[model samples]
Target: MSTTSNPYRGFRYPAEIINQAVWLYHYFSLSLREVELILAARGIVVSYETIREWSLRFGRTYANSLKRRRPRPGDKWFLDEVFVRIRGKLHYLWRAVDQQGNVLDVLVQSRRNKTAAKRFFRKLLKGLYYVPRVIVTDKLGSYRAAKREILPGIEHRQSRYLNNRCEVSHQPTRRRECHMRRFKSVRQAQQFLATHTRIHNHFQLRRHRLTASEHRAARDHAFVAWRDATGTALIG
Candidate 1:
């Protein structure tokens, strides 16, 4: 396991408390105030604003740590984009997931045109390193146009229901949107969703495929990974 330098150097609280507060915020669909309430219930007197700062400060850093520890993405990639409302303006959230539902990358953009598609493709390529054996997407003309320009050789499959895996992946974002009363800005949506996806992917072990004992073991393993990723175990 690779070690991450501690990022909690000057924080007044211990690493465990700071990591727990951030975990509660992103690991679940709870608002900052809601997280504050839960911590208050536990006799911890952290304010909502402080929790917000901690999430903003540590969320993406921790998410990147977790992503680094993840296995290589599947050879077959599923790509999709969904519309999100940011302060009443429409924006696109482009996401890619592997066959087993591991999130590869996410981008928020103002358009879903060919240019937007190409931009997302570039981001995915720069991050994932390896080229996919095949790409699956819905019947979006922009996808075909982008693929033709950027990844001409890879197989591109498109159908109405062919990319159900990517479609189903949007459910968690929808739930989070409703909980937060919609995102305040595009950057906020992008940042939160990026962190949210990684945290979700870590614990979403597809329980139906596992026995009860296996599921419990998987959850425990994920918790240990979370601790390592968040620097809680390392510091405390």
Candidate 2:
């Protein structure tokens, strides 16, 4: 077990157990019970239910911590939405990513109308300082209107391939969604995606055209930022 100071002091599980639980959650797309079982075989006698609590309570907290210290996302933005099942119905996830595949923001909504689009844009512009030079989206009228209302001077491109960057960005979320059988509430889906976005941005290496060493260095640098921001180990 790790000898590090326990962040959740007096909790039955040690830092090692919590670390392992979080690791499994991020790396293996493991559910809380799966994390408990994985650790149980290794002789850590924690419960699946507690693991779930740890993840929900701490996961969002940790992810937010990492985001605070992460570098500002690049200015070339790609935006899109994906459908998530909530209570056997469809909910939309609005996602924003930078040119280098860094996730910027994620918003969940019951509708995809102009108001929904505006809300998503508000979240995206919250922490960002400089405006993106290019905002890429599909042929969505709401996005076009939101662009005009919020970021008037920003160049909005409604091209086919331009949004491939963000469309592909949802793959990890989709993978995780498959595990939970889908969210029961829109709020739950929103919360999970928000955390996942920060986690993804923390670890994503802009692996395009870089040498192995450069990629490693970039990843290491990102982790350092994550640690400084969140005060948690980059367990993945």
lDDT of 1 at 207: 98
lDDT tens digits by residue: candidate 1, 1-236: 23546577778888788878888888788889999999899898989999989888888888999999998989999999999999898999999999989999999999999999999999999998988999999999999999999899999999889899999999989999999999999889989999888887788999999999999999999999888887777664
**What is model 1's C-alpha RMSD?**
1.5
Runs off by more than 4 Å, candidate 1: 1-5
Best by lDDT: 1
lDDT per prediction?
0.90, 0.78
> TM-scores for all candidates?
0.96, 0.88
Error of 1 at 37 (Å): 1.4
**lDDT of model 1 at position 187:** 82
